[model samples]
Target: MGLVGAATGPSDGRRARVRIADVALHAITRRAARRIDHIIGDSTQARRATELLKELADLLL
Candidate 1:
């Protein structure tokens, strides 16, 4: 059978947005250790996510 397209909903939009934000956050967090201000130009959500990720990393490390 061929692939079928699924209907999109609000949750789908939210998930897509979250995924994009996560990618940005990860990139910033990975690079920030070497360049602290590199992620300053990103969106607020990305920055907030990065902060949370950093906290989690610190806890785990």
Candidate 2:
């Protein structure tokens, strides 16, 4: 989110520009998570995306 535009704006928390690869990685990972939720979260007792991601990250790392 703090990837573009003027260095001093409403979405400016960065002190330097970020690489396009980093931005693209974040966007792709975010969309993948949304896709997982869409595929597996159709039930009434489905888990939240945040919790599921954290769980997987904890296990993997």
Candidate 3:
């Protein structure tokens, strides 16, 4: 399996704690860096993306 697949799962299947944390950060950073144009395709999508991005920023910065 991939790094993330190895990192997450039941206790018996989980990877090292450091590996899990690294994979989690790698995932969140990639997701948080996605451009709006790459994501929003319509007004409905735009509104939802806007709200969620705002919430993410509020929680992070």
TM-score for each candidate, following the candidate numbering: 0.32, 0.26, 0.36
Q: Number of clashing residue pairs in every model?
A: 0, 0, 0
Instruction: Report the C-alpha lDDT of model 1 over 1-61, residue by residue, as the tens digit.
Output: 1122333357665443223355566777787768545546668867798899999999999
lDDT of 3 by residue, 3-37 (tens): 54334356855544434457777888998898868
Ranking by TM-score: 3, 1, 2
**Model 1 Cα shift for residue 47 (angstroms):** 0.1
Q: Judged by TM-score relative to the true structure, which candidate is superior, 2 or 3? A: 3
Q: Which ranges of candidate 1 are over 4 A from the true structure?
A: 1-42
Give the per-residue Cα lDDT of candidate 2 at 11.
Answer: 70
Worst 10-residue lDDT window for candidate 1 reads: 1-10
For the record, the alpha-carbon RMSD of candidate 3 to the native fold, in angstroms, is: 8.1
Model 2 accuracy (lDDT, Cα): 0.63
lDDT per residue as tens, model 2, 1-60: 455433434476655443445687798789777645555665643656567878999999
What stretches of model 3 exceed 4 Å from their correct place?
A: 1-39
Clashing pairs in 3: none
